[model samples]
Target: MARPTKFQPSYCDQVIEHMTEGASLTSFAAEIGVARSTINEWMEAHPDFAHSVRIAKAKCAAWWEKRGRELAVAGGGNPALVMFGLKNMGADDWHETQRVEQKTTLEAVDPLSALLTQIAEGGRRITDRA
Candidate 1:
């Protein structure tokens, strides 16, 4: 016989509530006496639960961003943590970095050597500039 599932329908509501309150999946799982993988599997098996979790996580992100902004404005928060939260919450508007790649080639690097050679050969004189 197959084993019974540990998930209960009511857990969907509880998970969403906890998630919106800033609980991460791992922490939430621990709080509810389940493994993180179990929660993940439950989400995969229950589409409605997955959707609810997604919404809750989005709200949680917004909540964290708001908290970060509040701390930044209050003048006593960790600047690094605030920036990290803001950057993650609003990546499109608050990207912390940009990457660029450039390539180039120099073709006439021997000009100075050639000039010295000419001077040595008496083809040009040091006083030519004067």
Candidate 2:
């Protein structure tokens, strides 16, 4: 007679994900209705599994920082936007850059008006006099 093998599931990725979210292996096991032993096995099999989940959860962070810099540069802040938002506003981090940028943009520009301006006129860029 052949012996039965342990069950391994594709959701191992998700199971490891939950565990990385500080979901204790036991709780993660229960959440996915699997055994804690199974989650442990998955983590053991793939070391990058945990790192992947953490990165996935915080995926928006790096992206927003990059775009924040983009918008600041486009809005004429250049490198100074980072400094002004960080040092002057006590931002201390990219997360704060988003909040400050959002607040300023909202207070300063009406979306509909900005849209109309863009639609009414081509992107009229000014040539540098220098």
Which candidate tops lDDT?
1
Q: lDDT for every model?
A: 0.76, 0.51
Weakest 10 consecutive residues, lDDT, candidate 2? 88-97
Q: Model 2 off-target regions past 4 Å?
A: 1-22, 52-130
Residue 105 in model 2: shift from native, Å? 74
**lDDT per residue as tens, model 2, 1-130:** 9545354455546644554433344665687676777656656766675555444334323433554567766765456645443342222343332344443444577888886686568655334212
Inter-residue clash pairs, candidate 2: none
Give the count of colliding residue pairs in each prediction. Answer: 0, 0
For candidate 1, give the lDDT of residue 23: 57
